[model samples]
Target: MITLFRSFFQSKLGIGITLAFLGLIALAFASSDVANTGTFGGVAGGETVAEVGGTSIDTAELRSTVETAYNNERSQNPDLTMTQFIEEGGLERVLDVLIQGAALVEYGEKHGIVISKRLIDSEIASDSNFAGLDGNFSEAAYASALRQIGLSDSMYRARLRQSLVANQLLAPAFIGSAFSENMAVRYAGALRETRKGKVVSLPSALFAPDKDPTKKQLDEFYASNRDRFTIPERRVIRYVEFDASSLKDIPAPTAAEIRARYERDADQYRASESRSLTQLIAPTEQGAKAILAKVRNGQSLAAAAEGTGLSPSDLETERADYAEASNAAVAKAAFEAARGKTVGPLRSPLGWHIVTVDAINSTPARSLADVRDEIVATLAEEKKREAVNQFAEDVEDGFASGSTLAEVASELGAEVKRTGPALSDGRIYNTPDSVPEILNPVLSTVAVMEEDSDPILAEVVPGEKFLIFDVAEFTSAAPPPIADVKEQVTAAWRLERGSVAAKAAADKIMKAVRGGKDLDAALRSLEKKLPPIEMVDIPRSALTANSERVPPPIALMFVMAKDTIKKLAAPLNVGWFVVQLDDIVPADTKRDDPEVATFRTNLGRGAGQEYAEQIDNAIEAEIGVTRNENAIRAVIEQLSGSGR
Candidate 1:
């Protein structure tokens, strides 16, 4: 999910996504409760962030939270930053969370739910991932965690408390709404057996050649499903960067260390060995003796397995993964023999075995000279990575000595290029295909930095091939005036119209299904009869529409025990989600299929989700959430001008 945060939150403002992901959860404080701020979501100096709901959600808190989350995330993404976070929907997600949190807090208030400090503290203490394995809170670690994402303990704890209060109230309420066993069984059966008749796709060639898609047809599609084409608003930003690689006279790794690293990784540096062999396992020692005696007399291993009441395990293992002393009597004799040689009337616990080595292969062992090129490449990359950091330190010193970017650039043997208005994600300028991964982490740390001023991290951006990045120009995201997207509004209007038609049609079908019309026949009567559907075995990853190549959603479908005849809604980018529950296959663990284990896991998740959703809902219903759009816009604008 943080990976998603990285890409989606990639923005010009260094912290928009990065800091958002870090501290956004922390920001979910009762912003509505933040007092004297007069408005919600405004940025000032480092200390000047505002709040909502009379609660304070500031930059410092957000920063702390971001740091903590990133530190946790470091296990997986060791080199990710707030800039990448925002570029990847990190900021947008935060906004969504802020809205949800506000709404929940208000809802909680409305419902008279009160969360106590004790409950919140207990929760904090109990969350093992947040706490250490020592089973006691390490205050420094906790504080450090909060600080990483830019939060203070006092502020975050309150938000956490409110969140808990809301959860405590709703989980029981949602428990009553959970699916019954009968329902689950029915659902599972349907899913397991659900078959949509095979669809023979009319090739795109058919449409392309026979009937060129008319403008009218495209328009009709657009009209019928405007939601599909209405992409979210995107921004293009420009910013400057400062990174570890922008300095001069950086030190390089010594040759000795490079050699040491190569030695350390020698096992990985070497290729694997392979062998082919044939073996027979006999049910009895006498049976093995019979086979081995024949092999000694010159019978092939395969024929030996067939003739001696022994089956060849076939081109089997030359070496056991672990030594089995019982099998050692047979194997030791076998390996000691040369290839194509027969051996082993050897004794074993599983009986007797006769063996023949067919072929043995050892990968080309890399000689020092043969691997010299790769060694050089490895040593150079390591040297440069280390050197770049050292270079950054030198750049700092150079600045103290009154040197300029040009002088630093010249000294470092790095070229300079000015980037257009681009954001941290590098997507603003149609991110080139050849960008270096090292430069990807941070485009710039401080978004609102002043021009003509030397910033600490300005040279921090890694180069395109090595480590390169540019400063960003950030901007505020505001809801566009309706007039700015009149066509979009018109498209939305069309989708709304289409949705109304689809829903009405579905309602008629539902009524007919209840009135004794067969579900399939009812569907057939629609303006477009169901297309021939496909039957497929799909993995879970293939279920989404995007993975239609794997297991496409059929217009018609079915499952195991119970049955549902329901209307699926018109699909949307977000709103098009539809599920028509039908039939339930009984869960069977003994089945050879792996999906059973998957189903069991899913079942457990279903239980957890029920609890989690209830908590979310209860919070929403209990809290008081209000939006100060203007304030939020101002914050975005203000933060856009600054860098982290």
Candidate 2:
């Protein structure tokens, strides 16, 4: 069975991933010979994915790694099945991952990096995922887990050691240098303060006909800044997008077809002896007996489940197939004893348990006749999906040959919707007040396109239907004649005049206030907020939008000498604001301020992240990633071959 996996791994995706896995566990595990792996379990000696110099990684081990991942996934998703997991490229994906790990481990050894055994133990000990109810790594729990996967500590440790060594080889490049202290202070200050300023805004709609600018002025502005108005170069394109939803029903699996499948794969529908069990445990042997007595005397399960202490009953419950004895400790004892039987006072690690079998629900495998309809429906949906994909492609092809969006939509029964010519800055498409964030990025792509292009595939919500757009025409942007924007130009001119006026007004008020003129009296003629003198702490990311804010300029006024007096400037966005920075807060060394400390720490981490990114770029460049994107479509096409 392990040998059957060879052809897939022989490919780069497979071999590369497999090598990574070997590289992870190669050091102490000694990949001497590849072991045979099967869906049922692992056995020694099988075909190898690769040999790290003299070391070999077994096919069985590769399968086991996949099984571990499967089990881990199922732990989160109770609805997932092993069979479904296998079919969704889950098994192949797992093998590739393991191989990559092996390769990394091999790479480390070839480079002379070493991972100590103590480090491997520390990793296991620190893994909260593997901890017991006591929040500690229980040896018994660990052993039980390994037993289910047919791995000994020695085997598991070997892999862990190799993984660490490989990581060690890579970590230095990722953390090339320590962060500077100067960066930390700057970062901390930026995060700890917010700039406060008053603003005056110019509404484009406010420009009136009387104030409209001349065509000469408008043309001069347009001519001088042509690049701002120029649209990006775009290509007209046509492409067929293939996705699971693009197709419709799978192949037509008729009654006979369904029957044949069900007959051939009846074992797939078999039901196992799964049990839902509850347990009551106590500390000492005598305490176990006492707890069993209490449970027998009708103590509540909740009371039995209280925290670790004397007279406390530790309650444990798990759901698992009866044969998987490790998933439920006490249930195994009860199942062995008999249905409706009160078993021990069983002697297990945490304490003793009073176990009872509430009910025995035995199930048998489904006969082919029972699930035939289901099999047919499943096969049909798959074929339908494939057909849908084919139809979409046909529609795209027709449009590419000079058909319109309406024509394509009419043929494929796809809906047609239109949005504005959104810009690439993501502003017009996705304003804070209008349009969706998802739509912005897609619309931005559409914004610059000049082509009678392919239907744009817009990302909808995750794992949901996508939106496709076909461009019919593009309205290339050209500067409108000033006559066309007469009203707008007039309004803009008024605001420009108001801005200059406001600065003069603010200057007079500020000087009078500073010269001991009544502060409230000085504000009489201005439309500014009165002195509540409020303050706020906001990060640098929140403060700056484009350029200089009033906070710094205002702060400068406080310590300004006689020669440097100038009128206060008003902000461009809102009502009149006067800024005054009262104090300069230094970075406090208080340990209680985790926010400050964490900001500093993140700056350090940012340096490492930058280095890691650089190394990733170098590796990718070295590897020369060639994407035959057409091949991807070919593979998907082959899988969705049955266009029902």
Candidate 3:
């Protein structure tokens, strides 16, 4: 639950909680009102879904949290539907999280654990999502993110405060958990245990009925499992594209304007000279004179400064600029010296200076005519950029004043193009490659918008190209008609029925094996042609090797007692499996082994998680939790009906 909350609320802000503190604190606050029953479709008192102490979680709050979680999940999996999410227990999970959060906050306050506003402010200020280009927190970015996620300031702050208080309450329990050495040794021994078994496969295809499903049966199956056949929502976008190239009437830079710009930057065109030098600044005049005398005696300045644990520094600057930065006397002496010549042990604000001139560079003064072409190009580019920006602003203002996208495009003398229907993932339906590159960026943006939403101006290529777009058509995610997907529905119905038959076959085989018959003999007894039985010997450690998932039959075999048989269902309606455990080899791990020490540390972390869960339950029970079952059910149904 903590992971879920953090992933949803802290996604944009990049807030994180380290594992050393409260990462193991998984709170699952199952409500005590499971038996509380009411009408299935009516709103209850004040529409409250749950109550923790004096705090009431109303339906609106519950709905918002559920929506946020659902949206966050959808960002990763576009095919997820509200019905599928609810059926997988998302609604109950979110409600449990909310109830637990409220309980923790209220319990903390009762125990004198206070969360200050300034602390919450610091958390917000440190979040990178709200930071500006300069890396400081920006109010505008913060507000915009809040609007995008549909969270208000107070709501976000309350969540942050609750998080802080919960961490304070659970820290001790999480940090203090430990596993003894003896316990660690026992766990390591278990990991080294091995099992031997015999297994048989019952493929679903062999059990499937020969006849095809009827229309009536297929319809019922499709209706019951609409989520399996439902398509994701898609939209058709209509947009107008414009860029700096679209404006053909920008005035060229005038000759007078070019001359004026040159005058404005007169220093750039003025005659100037700069020298590159290697100078060593010494703290004492005596040391400076010594280094200068060495250089004048044919020693390089760098070599002379080696005795002082320093070296000459290289610099290139105009004479006047260097004079203003250092001493005028130092600059004059350095500049007057010929290339490859050494100069003065002079004094400046920094210290005594020993200078060596490396090279001289001079720039001749230029008239206005010499820089005319350069100035004209610079001015032309600037004007074009400004005009493009102003034009986009005008279009935005026009939108704010209620102008339609067509009107804006027509007035701007640009063409408005419409795209075929496309999904939120940017794939055009029935024509994958037909979507223009210009519309690619806005496809996902416009996918969620209402048809009546104002045209959005998107800078596709920064200042170079932009698009103003709106949704032309919207098709909400839903199951296609039974007629349109009969073949798929029929295939699904057959697979489901076949899975049931396969489970029965697996059960019969297991019963026969448990009844003292050999595994091969039991397979021979079955009159139907069945898959051959296979023998296996596997070490427990091998099941977890390389972090790969253990195959179902092998995993089930390891958990069974010796000489026992169990039936296991395969995933994805593929088949069923039966395993008979034949032998068990007990592990004999030495106490001094390195793996034992590692096991102790890992097992202690698991124990810490158990401790955290206990604390969560105790806090909730002390605070007193009650939930409105009918209200929660109604909210779930409403959200499912909305097809979010």
| Top of the candidates by lDDT | 3
* lDDT score of residue 434 within candidate 2: 33
lDDT per residue, candidate 1, 1-644, as tens digits? 12323443333212211222222343222111122223323454244333444544544334333333333343345234444454554444555554445555555666676665655665565555354333444343354345323355775665575555434443333221233344445445545443322222222111122223445654565555543343222223222334444443544556676677568767635765444657665655776787677677777765654412224655534244212423566666766678788777665644455667787666766755666666565555445544654554676687678876556556656665444444334344334532333444433222222244343432222221333232333343223444455566455545454556555555665677668886566656664533443333332222443734432234333331134444344344111212233433333323434444344434544554455555555554444344455544555544333332
TM-score, predicted candidate 1 vs. hidden true structure: 0.38
Error of 3 at 17 (Å): 7.1
lDDT, ranked from best to worst:
3, 2, 1
lDDT of 3 at 435: 73
Minimum summed lDDT over a 10-residue window in model 3 is located at 23-32
lDDT of 1 at 180: 39
CA RMSD of all predictions: 17.4, 18.7, 16.1
Per-model TM against the reference? 0.38, 0.37, 0.64
Candidate 2 residues 1-644, lDDT tens each?
Answer: 01213333444333212213432332212222223343222222354544433455454565445444443454345234445566677655654445445555555666566666655666677655445444555454454345323456787677667545544544443221344455555666645544332222222222222444576866664565443333322222222222345444445667776777676666457874544445444445675565566666776444442222222222222233322322365556766666555667765433455666655655677876676666665556445534544554665577578777666555445655544433333333224433335454344334324454456443243123445565444544344555655565445554555555555566676687668775457666555444454343333444444566636444543333422333443343222344433333334434344454455445544554455445434443443333333432332333222110
Order by TM-score, highest first: 3, 1, 2
Displacement of the residue 287 alpha carbon in candidate 2, Å: 39
The alpha-carbon deviation from the true structure for residue 141 of candidate 3, after best TM-score superposition, in angstroms, is 3.3
lDDT of each: 0.45, 0.46, 0.71
* Deviation (Å) of 465 in candidate 2: 8.2
